[model samples]
Target: MGFIEEFKHAYAGDETHHYHVARKQVTCLHCGGEDFDRGSALLNTTGLTFLRLDWVNREAHLLICAGCGEIRLFLEKPDRV
Candidate 1:
């Protein structure tokens, strides 16, 4: 699976538990890992969108692989289930 499937798996499990994935679940570039921890990073810019002020400045959502420590970033946050 790619980020899509991996993300789905992560949010499907225990809320407080670490992500659990199988082989070939998460891969990007030369990165390969099964589990990930999610978070956000602030982008250096100006403005705000959370309050519908502007889109010039926004945060990037990301997932860090538990196995290889590789970080995957997305312009839009992944959906949660």
Candidate 2:
């Protein structure tokens, strides 16, 4: 399987994984107008061991606003329980 598939599988098996997404308005802090476009990095992390099969770390997506050129970033991971 590809890297992405592997990551997903690991996340599914790890209950301690901290996976979450943060949503922010892509409007200027001064002016509330939705207008933005941005790029974000993808990241994934996995444990190193015989249980390496149970670890994962990777990027998901980018946040953008098509109104006022505002851009937001996102970095999500499974929440640790």
Candidate 3:
């Protein structure tokens, strides 16, 4: 499934018991819009910097606004095993 669909599934299913995703009050800062496109924050060069620093433990989540293309970042804590 797509990132957004996966997010919706996790939010509505038992997957949320083990994982945390910030879907609350997420809006576009630039356009003040409520619609967004979910994606991986590590899909870009910026997230690659963390890999180079051995900081790959954490995962960065991204929400791209459908209106003005504003991106919001949310960092996930490292998983244990």
Candidate 4:
């Protein structure tokens, strides 16, 4: 699917407002700022092990504090695969 479809698939039918509520609880570690610029990282890996399917690529969520430019990268919690 496309980007929008992928997002919908990930969140199911839940609204993103819940994320806003959770966001309110976040604080920058460096400067203790509440405001942040959020984004996602699309990553791809193609090393020897990855080529042999020993490793898989995944996306990361980024939270950058506006005040101090400190960044936090969030990866999904691992589950049984």
lDDT per residue for candidate 1 within 1-81, as digits (tens), equals 121222322344433213322322344334554456676666443323333535633556666766666777666554432
Note the Cα lDDT for every prediction shown. 0.48, 0.36, 0.47, 0.46
Q: State the lDDT of candidate 2 residue by residue for 1-81, as single tens digits.
A: 232322222222212211224433334443454433334444434322333533433454343444443434444532222
**Steric clash count of candidate 1:** 0
Pick by lDDT: which candidate is best?
1
lDDT of 4: 0.46
Candidate 1 clashes between residue pairs 3 or more apart in a chain or in different chains: none
Clashing pairs in 4: none
Candidate 2 vs candidate 3: which has greater lDDT?
3
Better of 1 and 3 by lDDT: 1
State how far residue 11 of model 4 sits from its true place (Å).
18
**Candidate 2, poorest ten consecutive residues by summed lDDT:** 10-19
What's the TM-score of each model vs. the native? 0.48, 0.28, 0.47, 0.47
Candidate 2: misplaced stretches above 4 Å?
1-30, 34-56, 77-81
lDDT of 3: 0.47
Better of 3 and 4 by lDDT: 3
lDDT of 3 by residue, 3-80 (tens): 222222112322211122443466667888766555553334444553473354334665556678766666653221
Give one digit per residue, the lDDT tens place, for model 4 in 10-68: 33332221123233456677887766566555544433234463354456565556678
Runs of candidate 1 with Cα error greater than 4 angstroms are 1-28, 46-57
Once superposed on the true structure, which residue ranges of model 3 sit more than 4 Å away at CA? 1-23, 43-56, 77-81
